[model samples]
Target chain A: MRHQTALNPREGDVLPPFEKTLTPVDLMAYGAATWDWYACHYNDAAARDLGLSAPFVDGQMWGAWFARQLRAYCGPQAFVGGMKLRYHAMCFAGDHVECRAVITSVSPLADGTEIEVSQQIEKAGTRVASCISVVILPATGVAETDSEHSAGKATEEGIRT
Target chain B: MSDLLSDEIRALIGAERYYPAHEEIGGAAIRYFAIAVGDTDPIYVDDAAARRQGYSGRIAPPTFVVETGQYAGNTPSANGYIPHEWPWPKGFRTIRGGQDYVFKRPIVPSDRISVRYRLESVEAKSSRDGRGQLLAVSLAEYLDAAGAIVATNRELFFLQPLEAGQ
Candidate 1:
């Protein structure tokens, strides 16, 4: 789907934050979706046996949240080329996690603009994970007027994730 | 550089094991995953919306490749997904350290992906509490029917020895 206004992101731009409260149900569904049925992610008893107070969110699930944040900030035509995620701490179910990103660099490509985004997932003020993502935004029509385009930042409220 | 890695484990480095093709990516699976991740993107759920975005059919979320093996009943052992044929050390707890992924192409419905796993490296490191930990780096390549890699995932796992007593 074509975005009404093309995104013209600049370096140092911080994307709008995406937040979600993960529950045991969310963890189970994420495990089912990713096929990462590790007991610590779903079974509370198993998690306690492993020294955790409760089942924790799968580290890989943060990657999906990062992708969702980028898709929300760059529009649907953008492609997520790569991502590097480093897990710092365990986030248990019921924690409210906020995903945030900042554009580190923006380079012009022949057909699109390549942007490196530094992303992080924070829970209760502590960083649970950090990520570096590369996204390629397709070269499309320029904004008809400067006021018409907010570099994709104006639609943050419309983003569901 | 540490003696934590046995010769058997060290020998696994650079060895690649290929698995059979996974079940075709279907619209239902894509939609299910999208919903699980709380993504309401229409391109992942509606074929018509995807076609409008230049995709032939509904596309999957970028990380969906991680689950393709599960559909084929390839449950992961303690060694991680795409297990090695050799026996892994028992009584060690496996912890995910990090993950890196490079997507070369978008995965769409009906795409049957074949996968291969390679042990990239293993090392001994000290955990935050000074316990000796064995770090294993594994690589999984998801290939299309044409044998071209569509995505590559590198997983970092830390195997920590279990302490005595429950």
Candidate 2:
């Protein structure tokens, strides 16, 4: 198993930002995958009708990317407690979106740690969306089993991890 | 022009609308979603890997439920499409403003899921460019075949009128 990320993130700690340039293909695939099929994500004419520059990325895609990053950072053992996003601006296809995170607070539980992270997605240096993610980190000795093991332990132990 | 925030629309607050139909989670859809999100998690695609992780079978990415039957599912209407679900002003364009998600369990292929939604709140707001519109907040809950709540989402949508000129 790969070394897990140390759960010792400090308040005001900044995680390395994730960067990606979204493409039309990415948008199209996401639309199909999510069954969104919304015109603003696909048809250029439809976007123009909406007075948009071009087909834009779905906001849910932003949430998905956030979830992926959290899973990767917290490792498979961590239970994502909750996530909240505030969309501030639009990100069009072909726009470079960068996701950045900062640890807002960390609270230790009986079996693990609960971390709150403030995150944001920026397009060309402009804030497109801001998010808050709360995750329950497994206890230090707990082997990272996919959630089942840890969740049961969480309930039995009253740790809420 | 009719006010977008009509009394009837405001009355919808706290009214729960249940999408009476259920859709089975399919492996193909899960795989496609995994690909779309650029998530290479084997547990999302490989049954063996998923089983090893103690899941019943191949499980889906945490965010996968956000799309489960969102646009393609049974509705009260015969066509299966819920028109004007957004409750925005007539001809005003609506866009996703934000979302909050909480997951209790992983949704696996063949799991039958149902959805229920309610308008949580509606507030009048202006964009940075100074266009006035309504921001609607709604909550949707996903339930499994056994009627256990698996996930929930609080979604925010921005309703913009065309005359505002972007």
Candidate 3:
């Protein structure tokens, strides 16, 4: 299915902020789904035993949250080319994690507009993680995945290599 | 190098691993993942709702590939990718440092998915918790049955050794 609206991001455009107060139930569900049953994400007592104040959320889960925000802003058609992230502080269950993203640059390609978006997760005013996403907004009148005419069809190797 | 992170682990860098067969993106897996991530999007669970959006049927979230395509290792799943054991130093534990994902298309239920991974790089470092250790990196790729690349995930892992002989 297609989302009727398409997200046309301009340089310096900041998307709306999304927030969630992660609960234990949320953590448990994520653990069961992802097969990451690490104690640090589910057992508070185990976490304290390991010297942590409380059980924290999975690092990948944070990435997923950011993806959700970007997908909502860019619409369903835009491809999430890649994300680069660094973990700084731990985000525990019950902590409020605010997710935000801003377009840093817009490079026009033959097939679409490749935008660099910077994202982050902050808890209580302190940054918990920093991320950058490369999203390709297909040009108007361009066919999806038509490599011949699409702009900036940067492959995965382009991002890491 | 610490006795824990031996040269053997470093040699693993540049290795390419592939799963034996492709697995289907079944509905149950998508449902479990949607509930786990706390995502309330109807398109992930309700086919009728997803149909409204134009999908042929219920579609999996972009990240669902992580679990369904995970390498099963010696404990490989009956119908999943072959498990590629993490190449950390013996006796050393590992922690996730970061992750990156590139999605070519959204995965829908009934789609057959195949997975492969390459050990991209390995580096030696020291963290507050250890005198000397290793930071390993790997990239996993997900492909559809037609051979189209669907997604790529890059993961960073920190490995630290334990004191000799427990």
Candidate 4:
């Protein structure tokens, strides 16, 4: 098992950003599974009629993407406690979307570290999904579990690892 | 109120599963999701860096499968997919109520996987303020290439029916 990341002050927190393109297949697959079958997602003509150049990706799908990004920094011991996202604009299929996140606040808690992170999903420089993630990190001074172990122990137990 | 059994809605939920996509799981799909949501952690992008940090390599963000039905299952729809029945009134917006995970193993790209989804269950309620509904849970199970279970996904949707322009 790994130890939780020690709380770092944002004064020196640095983040890496990257760009990715969503294939029409990816968009349709997500929509089909999530049951969020708004026509604008799989129907390009409908989307264009709605003012988009092509089929749009669902914002919830974008939100799910944001959660995964935040967890990368928080690590295996990271627990997403809360998440909220606002769809600022349309992200059409096959468009290049950029993702980025930065640590906003890190506070030590009784059992673990509380982290607040801000994330954004953009398309061709337009913001698609912008959101905040609240997570609980594994605490310091805890015994390491070399095998399978839940990352964050329930508050009832004294969490040292 | 409990209109789930209504013939119209069930027809939508019972559509044949769409093509379940094959994904590396930790690939760009995850990165895009992260970026769209605004996370910039190194683990999402750098394989060497994540290995240095003790992970085997790049991995799908925790919610990687939220949108992919390979893990959530898909059904063929004669009338098209009906989605979990939603019955909210006015200013109706929905969101993730919360999520809990029991990771049997951390997902790694080398692991071949797929998901099967079931509508699971639904709940509905009504009041004078208008009408409302909740998708208490939509359950999904992840399977390795050999057909071993890897993870489970349960999503909740809170629906508000009345508000304009949802």
Candidate 5:
């Protein structure tokens, strides 16, 4: 096991930004991996039939991106307890999108620290989607298998909303 | 209620269905999902690294449950895929609006899971784009082989009118 120090998150701290340019192949691979063969996501003709210029990225894919960002920032010991996302605009293949996150709140638990993060994906200067996520970072020497500190307990406590 | 929300559609609120269990989660499936999402987290692909982290084995990505049905005996509809069995109102196109997820536990390889979906609510609203639309909210509870709820997903779908040229 690689040793990782606990993430000391502070409210209002902004995380480093990352960017990706969506492409037809990337969209197709995502669809295949997720088993989402929605025609509008893979067929330009089908998208045009629905009044779109081209196939668009799946809204759920953003959730995966958000989780990935959280995992990258919080390290292997941190567990994403919950996430809420809202899609505000469409992003098409070939559009460059930037992802950003800011720590909103950090609450201390007996076995871990719960951090709330606000994240958004932007295409150009316009926002494409936004997300709120709850991540639990276990204290040093605490193992994730500890029943009391499980992600389920975090949701049941209504801390994710 | 908007003219687009029919009586039959309203009745769908609270409807529930259970999908069959998915095949045991595998290391390959987890790795494929992580790669597709462009995640480089070794814990999702390297069991030894995961064991060092104190997990029983390599764990699936948090959002991987969304694709579990792909491995089920009966392929279920993809997320946001409205079945034709529903008396869907015509002249409207359905699009995904958003989603929420609450993961209760780490999903490990060999865990067989199932989902129970319930229609939570349907509301009529004016979209920001100045179109009348129906916002449907549904909940999916993911269960493990022992019937414990492992996670839950809330999905939002918007049904809007087809604009000019559509």
Candidate 6:
């Protein structure tokens, strides 16, 4: 759960790329729990009936997966501002999903560090999920070390104003 | 062309329901989601560390929204699992295509989060394999306690059948 650094991406600063091989349990879990019981995510008969190659994974699952991928690089306090992903290919259960990211650009912003992240999730070299993440890092002057981010981003407000 | 189906789908957007998840719920979701990702951030846990960071208390991980909001509009399920409950012929596979999320502001505790859902549009397109398939896409807006738009979600799902044996 402890996070890694995502602020500076040097030429070879590639955090370990991740590959997750999903099982039917993964798909079924999505269906049963997260209100995502789409047969393509679980039932093979449903997949073939619907004209898919195999039972695919849940998009919401990937939502979390994408966040996890970024978390791996950005450390804990990475504030995701805007996220957009296009699903290019189908990710079937039992397929090893490879998720990765490259820090496309890092710039200092008024509020904090602006880290624009380019992300990809591939299954055997085929892109499954491709995304761009705009994350707000701790303020440069304030966040001297990753430990400050360990708690969470500083907030100006709580539940009750 | 007729927008009848589009209109009908648009009508399918139901009344908004605000699932009031408090700090505990926020913390639980952050824990679960982090567990799924194998993250061990103090923000996710270690309240003392959180206090040290001047957060007052621990803050849930960012993607905690998925945990708090992903299953927002679930229909009842026979099993223990949460079902998508989309009105379609039974036994069709559903695959989430993608999402476009715009976070107007960071999520915080005590916020009465409400997701306003609308059927953006649905269209039948020819799959890469040359088969005509239905793509149902919807949009949901996450509103804060004061009702300001916190985030906008545009999601697409490919409805198909499950594949052959595992």
Clashes found in each candidate (C-alpha, N, C closer than 3 A): 0, 0, 7, 40, 0, 20
DockQ of each: 0.43, 0.32, 0.21, 0.13, 0.33, 0.29
As a whole number from 0 to 100, the lDDT of residue B125 in candidate 2 is 83
Question: Runs in model 2 with CA error above 4 Å?
Answer: A140-161, B1-3, B70-84, B87-89, B129-131, B164-166
> Residues A44-128, candidate 1, lDDT per residue (tens digit)?
7877766668988878888888888787677666789999999998998889888888999999999989999999999899999
Q: Estimate each model's TM-score.
A: 0.89, 0.83, 0.78, 0.49, 0.87, 0.73
Model 5 lDDT, residue A106, Cα: 96
Q: What is candidate 5's CA lDDT for residue A143?
A: 38
Q: Summarize candidate 6's per-residue lDDT along A76-148 as a digit string, tens digits.
A: 5567887887788777777887777767777887766877777888988888888888777766422422443
C-alpha lDDT (0 to 100) for residue A70 of candidate 6: 63
Candidate 1 lDDT over B53-162, as tens digits, reads 56687788887876444544455755233333334566566778898999998898788888888888888998777768889898988888888999999999887776
TM-score of 1: 0.89
Higher-TM-score candidate of 2 and 6: 2
Itemize residue pairs with steric clashes in candidate 3: A1-B53, A1-B54, A1-B55, A110-A151, A111-A150, A111-A151, B73-B83
- Give candidate 2's whole-model lDDT: 0.73
Candidate 3 Cα errors over 4 Å, as ranges: A1-4, A44-53, A138-161, B1-4, B48-54, B67-87, B162-166
Error of 2 at A51 (Å): 1.5
Error of 5 at B3 (Å): 0.5
Interface RMSD of each: 5.5, 6.0, 9.2, 9.1, 6.9, 6.3
Using lDDT, give the best candidate's number: 5
Question: Which model scores highest in TM-score?
Answer: 1
Q: Write the per-residue lDDT of candidate 3 for residues A45-159, one digit (tens) a residue.
A: 7666445688777777777777666655664445677788777777888898778778999898898889898999899999988889888776653223211112233222211
Tens-place lDDT per residue, model 2, A54-134, is 988878788877777676566555677788988888888778888877889999999889999998889878999888999
Better of 2 and 5 by TM-score: 5
Clashing pairs in 2: none
State each model's CA lDDT, in order.
Answer: 0.77, 0.73, 0.69, 0.55, 0.77, 0.59
Instruction: Say which candidate scores most in DockQ.
Output: 1
